[model samples]
Target: MDSSVSSLTQYGSFRKPTFPLSNSCRHKPRRWPLALRFIKGAIHHVILVPILLHTLFTCIIVYIHINIQTLSVPANIVPSLSIVVGLMLVFRNSSSYDRYWGGRTNLQSIGTSVRNLTRSFLVCGPDRDEADRKETEKVVKVLVGMLYAVKNHLRSTWGHGYLLPEYKGLLPEGMYGFESEGVGLVLELAVVVERYIKRGVDRGAFNAPQSSMLSSQLNALVDAYGKMETIKLTPIPIAHQIHQKQVLALYCCVLPFCLVDELGWLCVPIICLICFMLYGIEGIGEEIEDPFGSDKNDIKIDAIIEDLRQEVSVLLDSWRRGGEEYTI
Candidate 1:
């Protein structure tokens, strides 16, 4: 079965997560052939229509200048448009990148909180008997579920039907149902974890100070959730987007006339290349603006959740073998 279809059936909605391209500057990367890079680039797939049209437009302008009429514009138009378009594209890309980086940092915070709280429960938690250890394990599993819930909420994949098999039967009876508001299920799971933290206090698993610390970690998880929600819901201003695109189109349309006077026929390829660069930069901003989506440039959220799951499992297994004396 197609992965998209399978995810839709199992989780109600699916955002197929792809690994993000590397941006590390610590070391240089192997350079691929220009042809291969062009073939594999996302810009080619998205900007093909506009590039072709721009190429044809450039050809028409060149033909008119050569044969029918000496149609031309002052060379000053090139640098003039270049400055305005350059500033707009720079601001657009910068703002979009800020949102992308913010989303990543908040996700890291959530993962850190989960690990801290789970470790506290397993090692410092009340593990006097088999039942206590079992309860701790259940709480760790709930932490995993919390991540999945957050993932679904960000993707707008609501409802209990989206719960995976591992997360099933974990929610309290009668609590699982359609989550119209999107955050209800995630909040419910947080409440469940909080209740267990309180139980640990009642059972003498944690002192007042320790209990307070556990609660603080839970608060951090909720804080990260709220931050992510803000990123997902709030978008860049529509007015700015409209004006920038208008200016970009205008610049591209006039560029050929400015260059046709000097370069003549050679201006065709030059204009095409310039169009590709300008449109490609704009397209990248558009793709990464909302980093939570399933775009090729969006964060690999599914992989992040799975990594947390495996880490929690490994910690719990080590604790079980060490009989709760595991301090890490």
Candidate 2:
């Protein structure tokens, strides 16, 4: 922490933070959910659900079509010959990934918001008076507090309950915590600002433009909270789910017909391999949809948020004491 005020303003540094940005913390397998076969929903699934329902549905249809049409080769091979099914599977897969990528774009917004907010703090005013110093101190504390709160909140954990020593006393006393721990801490800090502004008005420290700017910054902080929450709560629509399942199922059902002759009984393993590829893709998609989930692909909100709080606190403490002030 540096109490030795930087030549740089808070807004300047935040707008372009030297620090790394936070990202979701987990990873999930790409395979489609195994239970997808059991679950109903995808459009491809609807087509294959009937096909899968009747065990020999493909065999019976192929057997009859091949025999009736005067074909010499076995009937099982008839069902697997449609190259279009394979093509369609590829199309479904690409579409699913597009959805996943879209979500990533939204998460990036939170990072930008943090950078901007930090810059605002960096460029803002400073003072030597006890009251001004105390006001500044309160705002700085909240800045650190919000980061820690948001990180843990996104993880839906109270890791902040122990990890961040700086914000320990500032939190609510009971259960039912925030969506993001860092966000909660920031709000607490914002409350302090509002109090300070009211006090400043009485004492005549803040002028018209200064007060307006401060209020705007506070609003931006609150908006950041809403945006993160929006990302957490409103993920991709569930309809694509049913469509993806259908495509994977259809791809699997046709595999046996495609390789029955050359592989014979070995067709089972070959077919299983094919299913693995399709299922894996689907599974990974599900894991990433809600980046905040427990899946490995998730954004590690706890670690990132906690780190932010610590970093901000460290900066302020160093500036406050003009040395390595708050020792761990």
Candidate 3:
């Protein structure tokens, strides 16, 4: 038992420290009470503006109907309006969700391609000589750099802020030919990888089939990059967005008028609840539509990038150990 414990301790000493998972499934739970949650979201500038306007309109309609007896909008009008507004909100949320899901899917594709290409380079490529090993290490660094660059590209952030500290020295000194630093860096890395492949083939380190597979993986990464760019640059139709907002605004502004005659003093709370629900739904769609941002609801891009880095590190370590060869 003592010998076993000693061995375990020795093994533990060489083990890497484990990090807490940061993906969606293991994210910190939100445990705020219902009242707190309501108050927290209620005070947001977006919701507050609509709530204040709703309250004002509710009070005005109540006074006018009870004291002056001058206004009465038919209650039947609400059913049709509610149906139309509900449908529009549904469409809006669905379209936004499509974009959010597409962004996530594309990012995953990029991550998969990065891992595949990195593994192919480190395990299958030529690492026979000291010079060959050095070149392979350089290529591995470039693979890691491409993942970070893609993350920054999606977020529309350029310059050094988004770069991984460990891989910074591996990248070129300045942005590549393109004006956009993130994209330019990725393109530059691709050029380097392609040239490395050509040199490997010329030196007979990798034959045609092996070189072709590596090139295909690189091509997959680029294809995923283009798809992500399309999602980022193209937005839902402006007309649809504008029209939905206009409808929502009109519905909220006129809502109290319809309720005041029936609910009297109770109309205020009812209107507040209805406005909150509708506004909250709309807000969710807006927040998620561009999932690459820093918002709580946005995709956890930093976490994803960190996972990619860890994956590449593991592959590099395996190569260094001369582990069982990995076939493409």
Candidate 4:
């Protein structure tokens, strides 16, 4: 009995009813029939400062036209720069979306590996004797620990208050002091799992092929762990980010000047609309660049973790009740 294994048993006893889980932002549906869905978490919050500045600048330009005679930048200037700005925004958004989708896929892979490994441990693993049952339970606990560790690892939330209360004491004392504690915990649990597989193989409970298959599943889990680390640690290029922002600022600032003479006071609302469109798209890309964050558009890591917990609980329960044999 590993302490981690012991903690898992205690944790498992308090299972709650599982609700539907969503990977997207969990917004309550609006009661108003005419409410716009597109503006749910629009760029408004992020671009407030820029929007205010743009508004003030537009008012000044309008005042100049009315009081000090017509003063306007050539509207032709816009068409010249619009193409470059459009392409950069397109590329920036696409690149960030790729990262977001990649993180989602990685999380899905981790979930799949967890479910597969847990089912294999409970069903394919030996459970005839008390020792076999205990050992299998230990392996199951390690699987649970792996899931939590991976979640914490990607979020960079480690130590005392970060983990679920039940998993608090699961990690060894040594892990608590490590710099990359969450990652170290996952690696340590993976090692423990391998050791248990070997033990099962030596006990004549699992054949070489059975152990190999289980080991491969564990390897898949480890691979996912590494993939997540890659996504979290590797960010979009700094130069690209800086350049995009600069271009967006320049475009927004110059827009009002271009349109003022043509639209007069109407330029303020028009410019505001354009700012919303451009800045909103840019904000969305930035929000999802690292989908592990708490932003509305960020991947729902907490919900995903809960789904894994519930799935594992159900599988464990089925095993305890002595259900029909589970196949691969």
lDDT for 142 (candidate 4): 65
**Backbone clashes in model 3:** 0
Rank the models by lDDT, top first. Answer: 1, 3, 4, 2
Q: For candidate 2, what is the lDDT? A: 0.53
The TM-score, computed over Cα atoms with residue i paired to residue i, of candidate 2 is 0.58
| TM of each candidate vs. truth | 0.84, 0.58, 0.86, 0.84
Model 2: per-residue Cα lDDT over 75-111, one tens digit each: 5654454354556455555654554454344334444
Model 1 misses residue 55 by how many Å? 1.3
Candidate 4 weakest lDDT stretch, 10 residues: 173-182
RMSD of each: 9.0, 9.7, 3.7, 6.4
Per-residue alpha-carbon lDDT of model 3 for 209-320, expressed as tens digits?
Answer: 9899889988988888788788788887899889989999899877777778789979988988888889888887777777888666778877887777766765676577
Error of 3 at 187 (Å): 1.7
Ranking by TM-score: 3, 4, 1, 2
Cα displacement (angstroms), candidate 2, residue 170, comes to 4.5
**Model 1 misses residue 35 by how many Å?**
7.5
Error of 1 at 223 (Å): 1.0
Which is the leading candidate under lDDT? Answer: 1
Q: Please tell me which model should have the higher TM-score, number 1 or number 2.
A: 1
Candidate 2: deviation at residue 284, Å? 1.3
Q: In every candidate, how many clashes are there? A: 0, 61, 0, 0
Q: Write the per-residue lDDT of candidate 4 for residues 179-292, one digit (tens) a residue.
A: 353246688788888888898788787898889888898898889779878888998899999998999889888887788888889999888888878887888888888888
